[model samples]
Target chain A: MSNGIRVAALEDIPEGEGIVIDKSVTGTADDIALLRDTDGSVWALDDTCTHEDASLAEGWVEDGYVECPLHASRFCLKSGEVQNLPATRSTCPHRVEVRDGEVYLFPNETP
Target chain B: MDADISRVVVVGGGIAGVSTVAALRAGGFDGDLTLVDTGEFPYDRPPLSKEYLAGRRDLKQIALRTPQWYDQQDVRLVNLTAVTALRPAEGAVELAGGRLLPADRVVLATGGGAARPPIPGSDGERVHVLREAEDADRLRTVLVPGARLLVVGAGLIGAEVASTAVDLGCEVVLADPVNPPLAAAVGIDLAAWLHGQHAARGIAVVPAGVESFEPTAAGIAARFSSGHEPRVFDAAVLGVGMVPQTALAVAAGLETERGIVVDTCQVTSNPAVLAVGDSARTRRDGLLLPRTEHWEAAQQDAARAAATLLGRPAPPATAPWFWTDRHGRHVEAVGRMAEADQVVIRGSFDDPAFSVFGLRAGLVVAAAAVDDPTAVRAARRMIDRRVRIDPARLEDPSVNLRALLR
Candidate 1:
């Protein structure tokens, strides 16, 4: 189920920043976390950390990796690969595009 | 004297030893690497007290890395073997099977063993010490529903085991010499709140010393120093911390006081020998830093030791940090909490989500948070960047913490 929907305005999230789109806005079953790296490249991933119930949106983003604030585990936002530990699994990555100054997120169907 | 540094041998198979080997390989070291560990596999120890002990996780799940990973890394893992002696002068380590392995450098991350105080019925079959996987497995058998468990000591281990036991539907009595343990680390007020959280979860907090344990008709009787009636328990877990394994270091004629003394580079007095983890104390210029047993400390030690061997500058020193999971709440504390001159409470303690940040001058020194990783994350950066913070703003949750960074 591709819930491809507009999540937030492009300017809403500054460069090298991230924003969390809760289920309320996305109309999806999961929270989508969108991050914009320093290069102005945007990526989308599951908001919940694979290790625990903490929100990946609450984590610190740096160099394309988002570090879970709970246990310091990090995940690559682009590929969803686990870059650090306490977290053995990777969060599901989603397809994203910025068009007409708006960010659109296509949630991972299998996530 | 570099002494033709080519081959390196690391003793002990815990995180420190394994991480050192991994770091060495990651740093593009193409030399012979050997690792000697007493355990069958180098598993993660933190899970032993929580998920693994609760039977929610298995040994394979806790293994730091797969066997194939070691092979890929070209690390010779000598499992189920002990380093009988260390001959630092000769750059060799004698194994339990009377084999001497030559090396240019040797790292002793022997770890430590659970401290078993002299208790009357400690020899009993039901008395358990949660250190190794075997200890957790034995304790798992008796942690059945409605079973009575006496956990001696209220430190991290005891409190964690007690939390796990409660989750297993066991009647847990956490006894300690002092009420609300870890006051020195988390402050007295917060410690009491944590103790109360355990009590609220139906864990009996016995703020008294366990005088002795005697075998009774039904189970083991734990007599307390508080003059209370002896309480019988189906099993007792000793969580009185660990004793550093330093016999081999002493036997090797290395200078040791409590643990193997090493410098900031993790190099022992004998240049060819190094020590890390729970069995190592950092010493420099006749002064010593207290040895730490936390998991992250071991990892940092391994990184520094590896950098030393690689002839590279040491990584930037970050504040020490540790976390604990108890009563379904994740509590994280970073840096030295005791060094704070002022304390700021962010969020109300009555609320489930709250944090306390300790500050020295205007900079954040340390922070302890319950279910609030955002605050702790900000606090860690503030401490690392040495960013000055306004105490009033810290207490006000409306003020963005990251903004204070700039």
Candidate 2:
């Protein structure tokens, strides 16, 4: 859907944590990974690892980088840029907007 | 002299050489820079053993950087050229064509060549070594399904080629002088498991030596020192090790021991010249450190070389780390695993996810993991920081590794 879909409330995702919103709108099963920064900012990206089929939601998030658990490739949550190897390409970034203490995930326009 | 450098010449266009050029530019060195490489482009080498040998990754995919990156960085990439001589006194490098280029500073990143041990019939047409792309291409041609292959030296390259060949439907026999090869690097227990993994994947692991090779009517027959019968194979590959390219440095009168000698800053005896990568023998605190051949070590060496050339502070040294992928599993090891007094293991090795941490006096000295990088990463941090850890807590899988960071 072009319109924003409410995924979770601010309290659902703690500071410096991530959650996988498995909505089918992104053309895959629960592919959107919503990350809440320590600064209380929410960002979204495709959950699938660019290097492998691992989930980014299970990865460790620190210093604005989401490191894949499988191969330890770190991806910048904000820009979806691959910061380390075993992965050469950036993952797809999803559009996210937060308002009224709720996180909304819009369909990735670039996808 | 204010260390005022204008033109910098880097020999060898491998990862170390490319990283040196890139690091120089990224570190804001806009001076005249030239990268002389023997190849058409700087390409990654690890894939040459596995993916490239398996024909899974192409040259374009494995290239370290696009051709445009050199042009954008204004780095004069002199491809298909080799430095014949190093005139360090005059700060000049002589290319193969007898062209002399003046350089305020020189970085030697000439990497290494595959060591071809002298064995009877080792020079045969069917025998090969996987060092360059051309070598991998040639091996790929003979690695068809139903092909029989004998790979010598069960180290990383040999094991990788054996795995790839097995996946390609080739009958593989990997032989080394010692059982469970790479014990010194991966520790004895893990090396045994790794050797077992190869055997489990339909590849034969032999603890013996190839006494000689003879070309038979059907294929190449290899005589083993283990008293086994002469085995025939379609082809053979050598993954023994690397011989550092240090002849040019030696001829140039640079102090060399094992490799081109360099101090902690990666500067040769002559400050105007520097060396990095497999060819650089580093000395720290008046002790000559062993030259590392891993890809990440090369990158780190290049960074230090660039910093030394730029007169900038070298980055804090981190514990040595390396990784290898085999049979669809990723293994990473950090620090010195060989010298640990005790090995604390987390997770069951029988199960797929496990990490073995080498402890010395309650501190993590080294660690190796199979499919579990979280432990390796934490172990690296603990080792680097010299953090005292409770081995009991380390052995307990229930204790979170990150919690130890605090």
Candidate 3:
């Protein structure tokens, strides 16, 4: 059931930004935040910030982490571990593969 | 100095103290670590005035760390106990039961108590103060529907409680001497806009301080400093300020002015005893800087204290930032906006989300945002890195903040 679904082209996510894929597409509990780090690596985390009601998709991606746009709480893109205060819980990170400039998401599967 | 370290005792279980232990472990400090706290568990305080006060969250929900954390970290958790003395000479801390825990380093995170201004009848049963979870529990009981609540001081805590109380169906009247509160922190223009939000959301905002309080059969009568007619309310909340719990430090002979005087490394006057959080104040060049009383400040202090304990280089310093949720608005401010020569509004006030950037010497010095945390976060980097940017580009919402950093 955890098939790698093509979500978006790699270029769709700009460096240092994120895009939210609706939970409907991923069949996950929450929408997924597709992040493109400044270093050009792609990562996926649950869209909602663990500390509050906020979209991680709207966060700033830099230095391999996504900062929650609500309170500046940051999460490691690779591990989804919180790197900031006011947020102690980590978001769920999913496996993603980039092939031929296209992003394939393995929903509910950790990378 | 680092070679001799073995045992470390952290007093208090608030964010500051808890994070101290957290940072110490994160920094690879495997020595004997003991945390003495009066509470059963370390919990976050910001929620005390908002979510906890509204009965939306519980004690466990606000706990800073899981119960297994202390055990996993191999740090001794002495819960429901107070540290009565800091015996630097004996190299230990005296707990309430008279047990002295050995310590090579002692960290004081005693936090503070909500200040109850010197107003007659201010200590009445109806008067409330939000600091500890117990205080929130007491205040929440009276926040029933149609309860007349008088929230004094329109600062962060006061404003937050007023917002929470109002949301709980209490008729809130927020009184403060300042016309628009938090002007120094968020700037006058933004302060006015923020304070105006109270009225827009059905809270009564008064530009006056409390002269006195008189408890009567009907309720408590509060006379405003503005000399207006005295008003009666079912309950009163004193949010004027906080009184640092410095008695312990003072009794221990730690140099304390307004707060425990600590150096840049979070070391107190006594090298063996260090302090952090609200109860600790930083002194540099024989000058004591203001005590940072926010949650993030406490955490930052803990990290710094941990670094000192581990004898490691300090983490990269960043611009200070804090957030407050009031009246359903998530507001955040970073840096010293009062020092800014100019304030630039990034978006229209009428917009759903906007930010005000304070600029000085062609650089962003501070920023406050309404429903716009990204702007504040970006502004924080600009302030910390001292990035020069065009005001026009900053003012334009279309300009990506990341580009401004370049």
Candidate 4:
């Protein structure tokens, strides 16, 4: 099961935005976020804000950055660099691949 | 003197001040450190509002560091001295006794004094604000069994005081302008839960603003803004709020907004000066976080500022955390959440051990746990890692949060 990637359909997420996929892994409690960018590109990152523990999913997505809802700190969707104060560290970004028109997100490993 | 080698003078002998000193020492700073306090001793402040009020702990137990620790750390302690004037550019501070101490660096740790609301005829022997040891001692005497106690403001401090009073078998009436206690900090729903807890424990909570107060034959009469009725009690404890001690910082030509304006590194407007604790307002994303007042934040801010001064990369902001104790139950909250978000409850709220997770935009933002330390600790990791969890899974008490990280 670990070797074969689980494919999530592209239609699962709306165009130009992201949605959290509710998939229960063997050891994880929460699901992962699958993002569909403006360019029809897919990127995956942690959905929670590193600072103050706000939700990144609720944050505003613009200019390839996600703005934290609570404090307005922005994090790059691609590189996950925190582009503002308050949140100094970058968020965890997962590897994404699209196979057979299906989106697959690898669990984030980099801290 | 070299620009890098600066003497920082921190005012206030409380937790914020000493914590800053400890941070500086831990940062490998060999610079001269001077800590001034009006009180003759250095002690923790939180207990002054709770355990100390209940006579469970004394001043010695609350002291953060002993005299020997100060000497070993090479920190100069100036007790019973009040800072009268701050001349920033001049690099000097004038004490009330007319002594001028020079400092290349200055830290305003002079936290704040408890605010006393204007209640006519409420002064004399029965009114007090528990900000100092003396205030707690005076209130302790009035906590005898069957003593009538009226506590104003249902804030964290006031609620704790009322809980202590109730535990001592005192007839306690908690009056507040808000509908329920802790509404300002947590929210109406959480506050209602807290209100129920207090009510079940026999505390009479009055959700009405005060109009006037007068000394009556029955002790004291309190008129409400509603004008519907008047209530009387034996004594009144005010827990309105704290007014930050920014006068010294302002006098020193430091920029002051709601608090002493500081950068991300905790550096004040004056480069040679830094502010921490309740007095410093840290600006992030154009908004000033005017001190979380959680003990951990103070220490972290001090450490970050000291490290920045020593030419190290600024440390990341500490995860916001705070805990409150009431009736043998520990309530802990982590992360920031808005009232508009969806709240998921894990386990039964009626149960002593339960946790509430706040979700927004399909992501977890904040969490509150009551006597659920394992859940609280797990939530802290998610908060630190910014992990998004399934709202349903988080609400399921059967799911262990620690396993979610893997």
Better model by DockQ, 2 or 3?
3
lDDT of 3 by residue, B172-203 (tens): 99999888989999999889999999999899
Rank candidates, DockQ, best first: 3, 1, 2, 4
TM-score of chain B of 1: 0.97
Model 3 lDDT at residue B267: 93
Q: Which of the predicted structures, 2 or 3, would earn the higher lDDT when compared with the native? A: 3
lDDT of 1 by residue, B28-60 (tens): 788899999888989889888898999998998
Displacement of residue B204 (Cα, Å) in model 1 is: 1.1
Q: What residue runs in model 1 are displaced by over 4 Å at the alpha carbon?
A: A1-5, A11-32, A36-41, A46-54, A88-95, A106-111, B1-3
- How does candidate 4 score on lDDT? 0.74
In candidate 1, position A67 carries an lDDT of 83
Model 4: which residue pairs collide? A29-B404, A30-B389, A30-B390
Q: Across residues A1-111, which tens digit of lDDT does each residue of candidate 4 receive?
A: 243246478777654456765546412344555666655677767777665445566444545776664445678878887764345467777677788788766675431
Q: DockQ: which is higher, 3 or 4?
A: 3
lDDT (Cα, tens digit) per residue for candidate 3, span A1-111 = 645999999999988899999999999999999999998999999999998789999998999899888777899999999986678788899999999999999987878
User: Interface-residue RMSD per candidate?
Assistant: 2.3, 3.0, 1.4, 13.8
Better model by TM-score, 2 or 4?
2
lDDT of 4 by residue, B117-187 (tens): 67776575667788889899999998999999989887778888988999888999888867765554454
Q: Give model 2's clash tally.
A: 1
The candidate maximizing TM-score is 3
